[model samples]
Target chain A: MDVLTDEALDLAPCGYFEFTDDGNLVRCNTTLLEQLGFASEELTGRNVETLFTLANRIFYQTHFFPLLKLHGRAEEIFVTLRAKDGSDLPVLINAVRRPAESGFVNVCVAIPVRQRRKYEDEILQAKKVAQKALEENNELITAKEQLEAHRYILDHKLALFKQRNQDLIQLNRVITHDLQEPLRKIMLFVDKLRLDEGIRLSASGEQVIERITKASRLLKDLISGLREFVTFDVTENPPSSVDLNQVVAKARDLVIRETGFGAVDLKMSELPVIEGFGEQLQLLFYHLLSNSVKFRRTDLPTVRVEIRSSIVQDNQFRILKDRYHYVDFVRLVYTDEGQGFDTRYTPGLFQIRKKLDARTEGLGFGLAYCKKIVENHNGSISTESEPGKGTRFIILLPFRQSDQAFI
Target chain B: MNVEMDIIRRSNVKVWGSGSRTLLFAHGFGCDQNMWRFVTPAFENHFRIVTFDYVGCGKSDLTAYHPDRYANLNGYVQDVLEICRTLDLKNVIFVGHSVSSMIGLLASIKEPDRFERLILIGPSPCYINEPPDYVGGFERKDIEELLETMERNYIGWANFLAPVVMNRPDSPHLAEELTESFCSTDPYIAGRFARATFLSDNRRDLPFSRKPTLVMQCSEDLIAPLTVGDYLHRNLPNSRLVVLRATGHCPHLSAPDETIQVMTEYLGTPSLN
Candidate 1:
């Protein structure tokens, strides 16, 4: 039971190695042999340097042997040992010369690098990545601060821009607004002069004054039209469900009945109750139908209004879970036989004051305001038209309030 | 300080788009939010595009531009982050042009959770120096000369032209009409703005970004050289540098249709699924 059993020592954690005086391996434990990729019996009498690379062997012969001989001890020397497969094993080895007994030489042990060192390397790499990101974040925050400051400055510039444009239009209206009182006062004075017996005027003078008054009245009408177009309810508006049939009937009564157009063929369909501004949609239809009535053959004019559902829409019903909420759409189509212009004029169709033809007398804000009203209802409108032929207008919108809320 | 007020200020941001993914666009020094207008309409139905200007450059309030705080580009980047936080924008695709491109990098590095990807249109981290073995293609002296030309020529033209060009009858924010007019803009502020845009260092922010990124480098870009794109590729762990077919510093303006084609394609392609 007390005998020296190499099997027991071979099973230890550390590798045990023994060498003769001439540097040949006398014996090695299972751990050391296994680390060198060899069996313990195979390394029993091999050269100790055979476990090292040739370069390592040269260092072992020149420096390691002398140091071992001088002090008969060396501890924790970092080195690589050649395995049986010719792969290098990183190790920290302790070598010491044993007292020579029956031609024995030295002993050595290799302890694999402590687990703490490998753990430190991994943590350091991760830390470097985190630190880099932190630095970048800091820099980004600083840049954002500067951009915010720029945005502040730009906001005022834009406000001034809005204010200045409004001021220009405001001036025109203000001038026209005050001019009305002065113009009325002048009219009263001219009437007084005509009624007074104390003053006598030529027929030419009377005609001239009448002409001036007529010109003034016409100027006021033009300014009123411009003002109506300029002042739009753009800022605050809410979406509500409205009936299309009611709006279309009202449009026909006002545009066709008042204009005295020949028996208006009105085809009303069961339009869906859509979520939008009811008045805005009514105004849009009123403008389209009125424009059709306005620009017709004077002697015998016929107006037909067709309302139908549109399958073509700007958006499709999409179901999104992770990225966004779902979206739903309902479409409506309006086709009229009213005269439309060339495709080239389509770009200018919605612009206020851009009169497409010289034949029309009214200001060109009719179609322009229609565009604005449709937009206010969270809906879209575009027209397909030809010069001699009629126009087909399409509108896309959300059918329900809940669906519009997702947007 | 005025956080609630700031929210109301950006109320004009687009409300009628139906796209799935949202891209927050930050323009460069001299321009406003409209710089992205050329490409915004192209992706309106597919991708929700968010565009806004730095305080002094666009429709943003000019009084917010503090010269002392905004003496560099880093201050402008903070505004971008503010826009993201205020709107509760997450997993966004940040599309930045010129100086804003680098600004986006700096922001993404700090708040990776907010930005899913970065598309740097024309970015240069370092503006003045021509680092060793690198071609920055401009000297500090050259920029000074350009600044002198802006003062001597550009300002007068801006002031005179703004009134007529911006007189659209239906335009709500009418001052934009003056943007191109003779230098109606203050000379001192414009000059300082130029200096802030042209000088900045953002190389430190490159390695820290963990989000996937795409650098859409314009070929023959006189402003940001190709070497800067390569530098970003080497530093960012997962990054791709794509050289676009077009040339010029502002692809969004000079080549809008092609520029929108490339951006819409990238914005439409989903990273997941």
Candidate 2:
């Protein structure tokens, strides 16, 4: 019995074709014609390349043909065949070359692999999605590390500031206490000379004693003022909510006690409560009120302290942060009809040891101390003054102190 | 380091025939050294013959198929040169078919002392039409269609050879062994060689040929038409053109008697004259 029959070749389970070496289709099995949805006569003598998609056709020409020409057989190559309606069929191909009378003949067969190809595409898509998710996770981790590094640097800077402030406070306490002991001794000796030996002393000597006494008293006042300024480090005091109205009443009482309330007229308005260093805020109010009393024109002195509350963005000011878009704040406007100085001295007016009037017997640190206190509370203090008309002081205080609000 | 061994290993070089002078044969893109089996026998008694597969074709090592090296015609020329150098061949009569004809021309130009003459059968310098000046027979789309046909045939062969059991069929006159020897190729490597062959433009290389050449143009070749043969003949300084009354690209396959007669007439004359 013959192993291969003509019937078996034509009716094989897979698609089969035979073409000349130049690629003209000479014969095709019924199975191949039916698979491609074509009649037997429709395909004969046509180029076998028409059975594949364009890209697959190019692959066949460049790779498949050259291989078949050299080796006489090609096996199990992945390819896509086009059906009659233009849909694609994934298939694997195998071919053998045979020499004919004129040229060469190529016998080929195609097996469908559409189901396996679909499974492969799904695996590729899943791998791509997982890769994208991994990349996003890496980005998030990098961002978190950057934020942590930034916080660490800020913490280091804040620590250094605290240590420096502590050192300055300690030095100031020593200087004030040690210097005051000698100043008290000088006052005691000057008083002894005026009281016990007054009958025997000459008139010129008496005049010298008077001058010495006056100079010693002024030195005492300046030294005490310097002590007040050096001790005003806000870092030493814990923050708390304090009423500005209460702070104002206390400052007014201190000012009136020093320079009797006989000539000057002082008026106060209702003020809002704010979060700050209580002791430092009280000192800020005291220094500002005293400046108004001391600088009064003496003929018709007028002083009014007006306080108001509102919400404001920190950016409105030159110094405070606008990081937190808006914050609760208290504004104190202190106006006085006093002997205001020249505007030329305004910039230095709030600097330590800046005296506008040398004749007045007062330390120059009052305004500087007030400015420092306002700053410690995360607020601002500024003054507007005319030479002989009056002076108005404006103070803005934020309700909160933490720098975190800015970011 | 061993250049001779490398070429022998890569190209599967085979030497046959017996004579003082050597004749080297290079196969074209589609088939290997077997294409010359019908023609080489006629000259075996008169001249020594050398045949070899191209880099990625026939029994040559497929591992040596580097796409970059084989992307241009120069790489194939290198294979021919290596075979000549390895065998210590001089005054070689080089016979090339289709794309291998360009490969032989380039080799001769590089090592002129080695080759006495070149016989280019069905050779085309360019396969696509350049419109105003040249028409190498096939259009770009036509070659594309031709390639498509080649692929489908390959796919069909692949399916037939797969594990499915089938009854073996036989044809008259064609023995089982002889029939099995036809069109055996590695599909992956063949596609690359096909692209390198058809898409190549060797028109500029024609003018530089110094060796006496024989351009064997087939009468009705769809691959290399008559016009390409004329172009090569006009450009080559020392060359002769002969149109064979055979049909198709491989005249050696279809019309071996005519291919042998024309090649013998050209090579029989002395070069020193």
lDDT values of the candidates?
Answer: 0.64, 0.73
CAPRI quality level assigned to candidate 2 from its DockQ score: incorrect
Backbone clash numbers for all candidates listed: 51, 30
Summing lDDT over every window of 10 consecutive residues in candidate 1 chain A, give the lowest-scoring window. Answer: A317-326
Question: What TM-scores does chain A show, candidate by candidate in order?
Answer: 0.51, 0.53
Comparing to the true complex, what docking class would candidate 1 get? Answer: incorrect
- The sequence of per-residue lDDT tens digits that candidate 2 reaches over residues A1-407 is 11224888888888888877656788888787788898766775677777887556645653566555544567877777888888887777788877677667888998888786676456545754875687578657965876797689768878997998798777777668877888889889878888995456789999999999888888888777777667656565457789888887787888888878644455665577888877778878788778877777767645544443333323223432211133445556677777887788889889998988877756788888888988777678877788887787777788777654333
Q: State the TM-score of the second chain for every model.
A: 0.85, 0.89
**Span of 10 residues, lowest total lDDT, candidate 2 chain A:** A315-324
Q: What lDDT score is found at residue A318 in candidate 1? A: 28
DockQ of each: 0.02, 0.02
Which ranges of candidate 2 are over 4 A from the true structure? A1-407, B1-6, B61-71, B128-195, B217-227, B237-248, B251-258, B261-273
* lDDT, model 1, position A305: 63
Off by over 4 Å in 1: A1-407, B8-16, B154-161, B166-184
